[model samples]
Target: MTTSPTTISVPADHVLVWSDEFANDGLPDATKWVHETGRNKEGWYNNEKQYYSGPRLENAQVHNGVLTITARKESNSDQTDWGGQAYSSTRLATLGKKDWTYGFFDIRAKLPCGKGTWPAIWMVGSRGAWPAGGELDIMEWVGSKPERMFSTVHTTAGSGGNGKGADAPIADACNTFHNYQMYWTAQQVIFAVDGKVHFIYKNPGTGVDAWPFDAPQFMILNVAIGGDLGGAVDDAVFPVQMDVEYVRIYQKSK
Candidate 1:
């Protein structure tokens, strides 16, 4: 069963606590991001076919006020842990750098448009594991269907195919940049594109299994190539990239 999100304009006051404008022209600020390149032994979840390259400028870089994450049709056979995936990409996360319990997030990005390409901006609880810990997928997109975007909430109560979430259509998703946003509070979590709210999950008033958002969660941004969501890739589009303009976070001040 899918959890339906409500639509309402509930404005909450907040102050900017952190942000990245991509003003630097080099690797993402180490203080803000780390290249998460450790899962080659067991292989990535969702049967993804990409070797996440660490600190590789060719795969992830910043220039002209934009952070570009590129997924190239190349193999990193040199790495001892390389999973032998057919493509190489980057996964950047604010795991150790920053984590939040509740806040307002704004991520402006232009998705890549190549069959098999999967890009996502999501969050996970810092102190828990897997579905029980809680996962908030702010946005997930597959290139094959450029018009559709997804947002889901995963928990021990429901995850994977059972995850409760929703999808919305964007006519120019691949062609233009859009602001993917999320508003998380003690009572509920709401997701939006640009200024339009599409998904909202309210506290079930049950227990942690249904509301793991009480703990700190960190954000992740990456372009995955082929797996469950991203069907078969068209090798013709070997070098697809996702351009991220900026990310901002705000929280209520004590």
Candidate 2:
């Protein structure tokens, strides 16, 4: 289910703050990304089955000006992961490498359509623990729901699958490139795709429990396998990928 698309217009005075165009064909720029390894103790917080690998070309790579995060069905008997699922993938973040308080973020990508695949471009506060700080899911797509995409925000007041969110139906997301964007300010967080606003969350000014995005936050990108929301897996689409053309950040000109 998706709502009617809304028009989005950027403010005139804005400056690029950071970006990765993935020009060279090879591993991602180390200076800009930090790879996450092992499934967190809580299994990535959603029982996600894929083993998140670090610095592996098979899982994360850049080629022909595009960054690819691939999820492959395989075994990792040496490591412990939820369900011990025989699959591997990549999770990239800018946790300590880079972070921002408020800015406009744009990522152009082509999603993967493998059943049970869950791809996301999101952010988490760099300060405190999960939910206590805050989280912003700029874009998320579940393979089971091929035509729907989501944008959500989580805080102490609301988090997880039940977090505040909105959806948009994009029938060709898997085969076509689309801009997943976000404009964040102290007043509100606006989420859009290809210039269409799909979701918005206004700061209540109540406190951290409701609005904990005042602090710095870092970006994250990953693809997971069958989990709470990812329902069931289909072995047929073993090696799937989410292609990212570029990621850019912008701030209001000073």
Candidate 3:
């Protein structure tokens, strides 16, 4: 069963706290991003599977002021020796160098649509580890359902240890560039797409197991190949790319 949407009260007075306009042409600001390497020992957590590793530009690049993450078919020569797979791509994240607690995070981008393509803008806390620290899937979509996007939060207690949080779906998420955003506070987290509110969850009133979002969190962006959620990747659809225009963050005025 799904949980009902919680009430979200946007403060009347707000100001921009942080933002990345991507005004620089060709290449993301290295000062703000650190590429993630190595494969997940258990594979990507969403039951959706993919082996992520590599230094290939075909997997990631910034050109003409846009960041692109492309997934393509290549020989084992292009793949990193993570586990076993010839396909390779890059995953970028701001883990140790930067982190934020409560604020509004927004990403503007156009998605890649094709069978077995998965792209996401998400976050993980900088605390202990994994679901224990907390995870927020701000925007994740499977190409098979290009019309809908999912927003969800995972914590130690609800991450199968207890149960996963509810999911809210948004329509027409791939055809156009839209702002996928999340507003997080000490008590709750609210998710929206293109400025339209979709889902909100209040603090479950337990412990860190139930609410581990009150800590520093970093951002992640990637385009993943078929494994689980993305279904079987169509061999012909390789070289698929995800285009990101900008990422912006705003905090409540102190």
Best by TM-score: 1
Write the residue-wise lDDT of candidate 3 on 1-108 in tens digits.
655544333345556766667677554567887777655544555554455654445666777778888776664543334444545566888766678998888799
lDDT of 2: 0.88
Candidate 3 has which clashing residue pairs, if any? 48-228, 48-229, 49-227, 49-228, 72-239, 158-163
How many clashes does each candidate structure show, in the order listed? 0, 0, 6
> Which window of ten consecutive residues has the lowest lDDT sum in model 3?
75-84
- Top-lDDT structure, candidate number: 1
> TM-scores across all candidates?
0.95, 0.94, 0.86
Report each candidate's C-alpha RMSD, comma-separated, in the order given.
2.8, 3.2, 3.6
Per-model C-alpha lDDT, please?
0.90, 0.88, 0.74
Lowest-sum lDDT 10-residue window in model 1: 2-11
lDDT of each residue in 33-91, candidate 2, tens digit only: 99887454346657788888778899999999999999998876666544455788889
Q: Which pairs clash (backbone N, Cα, C closer than 3 Å) in model 2?
A: none
* CA error at residue 251 for candidate 1, angstroms: 0.4
Candidate 3: clashing residue pairs, number: 6
How much is 243 displaced in model 1, in angstroms? 0.5
Overall local distance difference test of candidate 1: 0.90
For model 1, the stretches where C-alpha displacement exceeds 4 angstroms are: 1-12
